[model samples]
Target: MKHLLNLLAAIALLVWGTQLVRTGVLRVFGANLRSLLARSMGNRFSAALSGIGVTALVQSSTATALMTSSFVGQGLISLPAALAVMRGADVGTALMAVLFSTDLSWLSPLFIFVGVVMYMARQDTTTGRVGRVFIGLGLILLALRLVVETSEPLLASPVVRTLLGSVSSDLVAELLVGAALAVISYSSLAIVLLIAAMAASHVVPTEVALGLVLGANLGSGLLAILTTLKASVEVRQVTWGNMVFKVLGVALVAPLIGLWLRHAHPRLGDIATSVVLFHLAYNVVISLGFIGMTQWVASLMARLMPPADPASKNPLRPRHLDPSALATPSLAISCAAREALHQADLVEAMLVGMYTVIRTGDLKLSAELRQIDDSVDELYSAIKYYLTKISRSELDEREGRRWTDIIGFTINMEQIGDIIERVLIDIEDKKIKRGFRFSEAGMQEITELHGRLVDNLRLAMSVFLNGDVRDARRLLEEKVRFRDLERSYAAAHLARLSDRTVPSIETSSLHIDLLSELKRINSLLCSMAYPILEPTGTLAPSRLQDAAPARPQS
Candidate 1:
């Protein structure tokens, strides 16, 4: 009972320690890492190196993989680049196992103490995250210490020693045990430490420990592999490449196991060090071997997972609506908000494109605008369905607020799309039918208003992405200014409408309708930014306020 209790305590410590480390690392550098990964697209070597470096620093490949997938989904990193980075991450994680081989008990508490002070007292986000990393490190070390202590008694148990001995004697058995240990813990470092502890207690032979070490290597690649399953084929290839490299390394190194045994005892500390060394060696070798071969790998992956036909590529597909995502309501909400924002951006772009075609009187460009409008409608449907699904779940305070923001923004974007499709598209198409053209000054006024609106929308997106309330407020101010400019433009259009000699009916009528639609699009686009800027009240008709309170003189 006492032994069982000790084992349970050790298990509990291991779990807590890992949690502390994982959480701490994410808290400190997750956003920074995410930003970095986002900009690492198109370069496989760079992404792979980044992956390795981050995993080394954070001490967890799972964290690296999770963040990597999110980046991939955001179109931050190309699939191939993500794969290459994952390869490096696999090797980087070995560094953590190496640290555990040394006596780290003394430093653990210090890291925790410093980490806590920084996390609690520091105003700088980067500094606070760094503190979290240290605190998590402390917890991981403390857990290992407890786990090691609990397993020490097993060394004296003849049955335990004999059982471990049998598994160690055969290379295949050792490999299987090592892999099994990793799977059971769902952590390569954990299994490696366990094997190290067993070896230190002389319950497992050197050869067996080495074989288990190889198995742990294979197991460590599992999380990356699983993460890549839903990712692009290029990503899938990178993960497969990493797995193949590790599996082959184990196979290639198997014969050399005897040499390793002769040079080193299978002591817990030694085995732990070996695991780290092997991890580093594997990554260094694979990265060197595959660095320049990214294109070749990309080709193979393409052949295996062919790109979807352009005709079949639905730009309006809602990405964050994966049922698996719903399991984490907060993450789901965040994802939904991101998708909604993406749809809004598409509509904004289409509106600009349509205006461009209208200004240039480019018939080819007008056709393209119609296609963009079609896509906008598809995206609107996708967002509506996605939000409906998201609304089905129970929501906490922050989540509820986020849901409201996404739904509000999505509806606003949908309205903008409707304006473009139903109003703008109609006017542009009618102009083509009537063979009408706006005067240069008329086109210029409409273009300027759109330009200002796009600028404000850009600011709003930046504010949302950064969560800068101050910036969001600044955007609100800009929206008010743009509203004033819009009123001035509208008045001028109406004045022209009153002048029968100013233009022909077809051009004048289209111009009048066009200006109204532009204002509506601008207002809706501004509304997206308003929710974050002034959540309590509607964004009233501030544009009308700056007008001379009358139409412009004819």
Candidate 2:
């Protein structure tokens, strides 16, 4: 019982170490890894290579799947390219197993000591995150040593020997046991290392270890599929396609395991080396064999899981808030930004339709337009919740600021949507229902203001998307011009009222309120510029300074 407890504790420690490495690496290099994946998608081979490199760093193919699936979900990369990337992720995992199989017991203590010092000195900075990674590496090595040490006593037991001999004779049972271990450990690399350790101790034969390695590969694929169960159909398609590749690889290789054990085992002097080599060669062959078939697999997945209708009224389903992306702050920020643009798109539609609804006094159109506000509200909530999941401690200074900007931008959009809905309601109740109309000149002024509002909105979205200082300055300038236009329009309406113009007198409240609402919308649209210019010191403390009286008197 004590021996079993120690073995279980060692396995748990191994899993915890892998978790630390994955999260620590993501915190340090998440954005760079995302950019690397994005830029390397020029072709299938490069995409695969990018996958291998990223998964190796993060120490999990499942992380690679989530990242790649997000790129696909956001329409940044094609499905076939994502599929190819996942193929390389498999090879990457196998490669890590090969590297970790070497004896590194000497460095474990050194890594833990240094890691402890760095983490204690700077717990919140990037250096500290690197320290955390070191600690995880040290723990992983320690756990592997523990697993080997604990298994030796168990190997001496007659009952354990009987169980081991039974597993060696039945390849199918060994495969299932190996797969279960991978799933339970949540790391194929861990399982492979454990298997290699066991094989080295003669607790398990090399042939049985090979079958278990094959099972570990399948288990990793299964884990990826399970991880993405709640994701979009497109994302699920990517994971499912990868699983299909694994299944095919297993089917093709399972038959040859017996032949390899007979012929290949004698050549490799070390059983552990033979097991690791078999694992590597299996993945390399699978990667090469399936690289070209990614497109076909993607097409088949598409046929299996067709795209959701764009016009569906699913309010709860977020089009851009991919939960998997929350691990990488930069990727999560990108998802939020895309969703913000989606919000902007909806706001633009509302603004564009506002003119027609107000001008024509179409109360029915006004009611229909109100429905869009619900979508805007839902998106805002979803984005806020998604942003909250991103660990602020993991973000660098620049990324932290970006996180703030995204939240601010989304809040401004939600407010604008509310303002538009209110404007539509006022037009319906105060103007249209009361049988009031603005004078020809007043209507012309509102029309011109509305057109400029639409243009400024598009410009604001561009400024938000690109963070271009020049365009941000232009947006700020337009804000001032818009305010000036509002004042001039208000003054002109009063002038007509003084002249006793019938239309102006009848629609006095509606005209003034309409102009005020348009100005409010413009202010919200131009607010996106501040975050861009404030950091650069190009923005002034107040626009009123330009109109202040000259200091000549002083």
Query: Which is the leading candidate under lDDT?
Result: 2
lDDT of 1 by residue, 1-554 (tens): 57758866766666556655665554455456666666765467678778777887666665566566555445556666766777677767766677676788899889889989987986345577577667767777776677667777767778876787677568887777777666566677767766666556555665677678778767767655764566544445555655666665677678876765566435524555664565456556666666666566656666876755758756656555433233234445667777777776777777777777676667677666566766666766766666666533235345566677777776777677777766555655677666677766687887787787787667666665665667766766766677787678767766766775344345766776777777777666666566565664545657565646677798
TM-score for model 2? 0.87
Output the lDDT of residue 406, model 1: 72
Tell me, by TM-score, which candidate is best.
Answer: 2
As a whole number from 0 to 100, the lDDT of residue 455 in candidate 1 is 79
Q: Which ten residues in a row have the lowest lDDT in candidate 1?
A: 322-331
Query: In candidate 2, how many clashes are counted?
Result: 0
- The superposed Cα distance between candidate 2 and the true structure at residue 42, in angstroms, equals 5.1
Pairs of colliding residues, candidate 2 = none
Against the true structure, what is every candidate's RMSD? 8.6, 4.6
Candidate 2 per-residue lDDT, tens place, 95-164, comes to: 8888877888898999899988988899878889899999989988998898888877787788878888
**Model 1 regions more than 4 Å off:** 34-51, 65-84, 120-127, 155-166, 169-177, 180-186, 266-299, 319-341, 345-408, 415-523, 531-554
Q: Which stretches of candidate 2 lie over 4 Å from their true place?
A: 39-43, 116-126, 156-173, 202-208, 308-318, 477-481, 537-554
